[model samples]
Target: MSDDVRDSLIPYDEIVQDALRAVVGRVLSQIVGYDSLPGEHHFYITFKTQAVGVDIPAHLIAKFPDEMTIVLQNRFWDLKVEQDHFSVGLSFNQTPSILTIPYASITAFVDPSVDFGLQFQVSDDDDTQPEPHDEADNDRPEVISEDGSNVVTVDFGKKR
Candidate 1:
């Protein structure tokens, strides 16, 4: 293979990214449709709190600042998935609340029991750039092991 630069009219990377994100939406839709989860099937969805179409609470935005992880399991309601986003009702120490998250905002999605996961690339609109946002924050691994057990990390990075 030779290293060369070429331009195409279609943006293949963007299209594939969109499709992969849709998988997350479709999976969530199916789980919500079942009305309950089977065995240890659960999701830990991590997303950018400040991204477009994300509708988290002000307090949550302050707390998470950059990103946040949400678990969809025993305590949720009104699960709705849309083209570019999804919304769900959750509780903060018994305080009921609703949140809408765009697929573009998502950074990572994990199912520890099944060892399945997906990590999304940041959108162009994000002003964070390639520079580290925070030294301590960058030092921490992007995906943390769930339940203190080995978890698989899937890399989408590839050469086309």
Candidate 2:
């Protein structure tokens, strides 16, 4: 057998990414009605600051610039989960800020209590560019072909 792998025309990368992002949505949805995270289940969600549909405060954007990680352990409110994005109220420096982050913009999701994590790779062909970081600095990758504390990483870049 040859070592050559074919580039898929089915956009497997996009499909996988979308599906994995949905996992994040589903997990969040579960906590919506209760309005609280269950027993020892806090989250650390990281996302791109400048993605297409992200709505965060200006100061946060300035501070994060490329990426930001928010902890959902406690002291959060207005947890809203939608098909493509999620919004929550969090306090930074004692100042409350609401963040609306699209699933497309999310780079990582971690439930440290369970040692679970997901990382993604985001690309904005025209005016934006994907952040440069380690393969697993919370990149929200879709493909789950790695070993590290239940962390699922999605990377479909073709090898040429």
Q: Root-mean-square deviation of each candidate, in angstroms?
A: 5.5, 5.2
Return the top candidate by TM-score: 2
- Cα distance off (Å), candidate 2, residue 67: 0.6
In model 1, the Cα lDDT at residue 122 comes to: 67
Q: Which residue pairs collide, candidate 1?
A: none
lDDT agreement with native, every candidate:
0.72, 0.79
TM-score to native of every candidate shown: 0.75, 0.81
Model 1: per-residue Cα lDDT at residue 78: 87
Alpha carbon lDDT at 88, candidate 1: 90
- lDDT tens digits by residue: candidate 1, 8-97: 467776787788888899988886654446788878888887788889888777767777778876667888888889999888757677
lDDT (tens digit, per residue) of candidate 2 on 1-160: 4554554558888899999999999999888855457899988788888889999999877666788777776678898999999999988888888999999998788887787888888875664654554342223434333467588788777456
Q: Count clashing residue pairs per candidate.
A: 0, 12
Error of 2 at 46 (Å): 0.5
RMSD of 2: 5.2
